[model samples]
Target chain A: MHELAVTREIVDVAAEKAEGARVRRVVIEIGRLTPVAPDCVRFYFEICAAGTAVEGAELEIREIAGNARCRACEASLELAGPVEGCGCGSFDLEILAGRELRLMELEVY
Target chain B: MCDHCGCSTEGHEHVHEHTHEHPHEHETSRTVRIEQDILARNNRQAEWNRGWLASRRLVALNLVGSPGSGKTTVLERTLKELDGQMNAAVIEGDQATDRDAARIRATGRPVVQIATGTGCHLDARMVKGALEKLDPQPDGLVFVENVGNLVCPALFDLGEQAKVLIASVTEGEDKPAKYPHMFAAVQVVLLNKIDLLPHVSFEMDAFLGFLRQVNPRVRVIAVSGATGAGMLEWYECIRASIH
Candidate 1:
């Protein structure tokens, strides 16, 4: 799964930031439309974090809802997944949010 | 020594020592604000690759598709037709085996095979490694046939100018809706195995409709790698991109 590769990256980033300190928690923000499964990330994070500074660290994930604005109609639409078109029958929709996958913060001892 | 407990004599303070290991009970913890993109490393490598390609004036296309979508077949045919006309090389990515690389070598072209082992898709770093080994010339076409996966490959950027999707008629018309990310990411769609249209239960109109619903700007070309049908259009499309 792509989540496995992504989790390795998460562990790497966290471990580097920890910098010899034992990590207590890792907070990540994933958008609803990012196509990354949170459960899979959690599963892989444990495996990827083993023996690293992030080992046994709590993984906290926050999902952000998809928000888009129609370029043609200028209407804001909240989406759960990829949509065919905006409600205003326009294919020109600019995504405002909900494609984010970021490591927000980390708690370390 | 006696202080609170007062168990010792005057001028002495009594202290209690812990026998159990309480590692973090008194440890001070702090939160570090990172606020960094998770794919930042991969994106940085991709940007590096983009610069490398732009500097050499090379156009690389990332061909993504399912396991049996005939990507290698289409690629073999494309390389043969472009022989002596346009210089080209290939970067074949698979979970294992150099079989595809052998096939490309048979076409008398420079090819590099990247066996990802347990990796599901090819990342930009892997492509960078392949680029160094392949060393395709300027004004040439480099086709990167990604691991035959519609899902994971769509999420990775290999610094290609455009992503081309190879989907056959047998994969069902609802492919676009089923895998929207892949459908939305590609610039061109090569609907291969058009010769099998009569035998398969694929609806061309419905497929096109579903494809349009997901990606309104994507160009779809129906071609059969087996019969060499509609290959001219595909070649023209490639020529348009390079020129």
Candidate 2:
């Protein structure tokens, strides 16, 4: 899965930042609809971090819900899963969130 | 002898043993929190590719859909129709083989194929390298046909001017609802194989309704590569977007 590739990048970034420092934790922000599995990323992170500065680092993932704004009704709604329109029967909608995959912060000493 | 604990000859021994390997093994585990975008590196490459394309005034379109959605067929037809009028190049991305690239080349257009081996989608870095190999000039059209997949390709942007989603009538109207992200990310929705509409049970109204629901502003064009039905409209849309 693409999670492997994503995990590799996370490890690279974390290892680069944690040079000469001991990594305590890694917090990642993942959107619900990003098509990336948290468990898969976590699983790959352990392998990717082997012998690196991030070895034995804890992976903390934050799942973000998908949010959208209806253009016709002007209503903002948060969706738990995939659905096209807003609750107001409006086809016009703009995605506000739940498409993110980012590393928010890291704790190292 | 230690004055603190009164252990007989143990303080020096303990201190010396601390630096050496012990007979008993202890397991140590630590936790670390790393918050970062998994696609950060890919996104950076995508941005750079976008800048490179923009500098050349090249309009790159990434065509994405499931296999047999007639993506290559649409391109073949488009190239044949736009012959001599537009300078078009194709970078065909498939899991294996250069068959699509060959098909595009048959139209006499410069084409390159990027076989992704086992990858389900084409990343931006692959596109960046393909662009260099193709060396398209400004005002030329660059069409990137992504690997035949509906899910993964929607997550990665290949530095294209627009992402076009191709869906045939045979795929059913529920495809838009089922794969919302792919439809939502696309600026143009090409409803291919309209010739089979009479044979298939595709509901035009429902399909359009669902497509609009997912992407309200996405322009929809119905065409059939087999029969050449409604192809002029599709060509005009491409022409308008490119120049």
Candidate 3:
């Protein structure tokens, strides 16, 4: 639902970066913990980027894997879905990385 | 549509009509290295709002939670208790209707309502626009009642000093565990509706247990807006934040 707003921001950023030039490709990074869906982003990108410099541009979404460590057992593992509790029967955990939401690079014409 | 040099085509592709002309090398095909956050605009706006509020010494608290987390109830109770002693204002963000704003106005406090027709969360731009129309006391509290959504609201920065989240006992004890982002983002959580503790099966220790796991620094206060339980402590928390 909020993907549209975030996509608008992405398109707007790409447009600003183009500075009136045409966009060819856009590279975006999303971590596993981030709730943004790559599919939804691509869908909204079509609408928000229409008739703009980013229109029809290739949207390359990079999904980063989430890494976390269980606080109870000190076990390191990949974080599961929102509802998935740790294997150690403890909700306590430390997120090491993979929460990035960034627009890394843009190819423009 | 190309923005610069005014050379746009239906598609990004330019078809050579008859002869193969040297591929025009305009600053067009260059890959710009921009390591920027996708939410740069919003983050920048949030920074602007932060500076604006700081200039006036205004303390803003962005209240966010599930739709029935007793956010408004908490605010209503707080305003009722702290009315005369503190001069506070509200910016209500409801999907539609000014009912929440009207409810806050009944307390005789200045309030502004921002109805996001389809938007799920309150962004920094909306708060900046609201600030332009109302005149809250300098160094006063600005409570931005974000649209009742734990997920989307957590992603937005409304330039508030803190995010006050409330979850009723009626909801699942694992509410924070389910919505880890919101729990981790907020500075405090008001475990509201404790008055019905007997009627509900919500485990206090379990709820606090999950909360501690997600946000060790976030303070958790038990309250019941309906019965005015823990209102004084909540007020004290607000006072400490402002001063």
**Tens-digit lDDT track for model 1 on A1-109?**
9999999999999999889999999999999878799999998998999999999999999999989888888999897887547876776667899889999999999
- Tell how far residue B93 is off in model 1, in angstroms: 0.3
Candidate 2 residue-wise lDDT, B37-95, digit = tens? 66777888999999998898888999999999999999999999889888889999999
Better candidate by DockQ, 2 or 3: 3
For model 2, what is the alpha-carbon lDDT of residue B203? 96
Candidate 3 backbone collisions, by pair: A20-B3, A20-B4, A109-B28
Looking at candidate 1 chain B, the ten consecutive residues that score lowest on lDDT are B6-15
* Cα lDDT of model 1 by residue, B1-243, tens digit: 666765666766446798997676668999999999999999899989989988988899999999999999999999999899999999999999999999999999999999999999999999999999999888888999999998998888899999999999999999998998899889999999999988989999999888877687899999999999999999999999998
lDDT of 3 by residue, B148-189 (tens): 997889888888899999889999799878888888889989
Q: Which parts of model 1 have CA positions greater than 4 angstroms off?
A: B1-25
Q: Which ten residues in a row have the lowest lDDT in candidate 2 chain A?
A: A79-88
Docking class of 2: acceptable
Q: What is the interface RMSD of each candidate, in Å?
A: 1.4, 4.0, 3.1
Docking class of 1: medium
Off by over 4 Å in 3: A67-96, B1-28
Per-prediction backbone clash count: 5, 20, 3
- Computed on C-alphas against the true complex, the DockQ of each candidate is 0.62, 0.43, 0.45
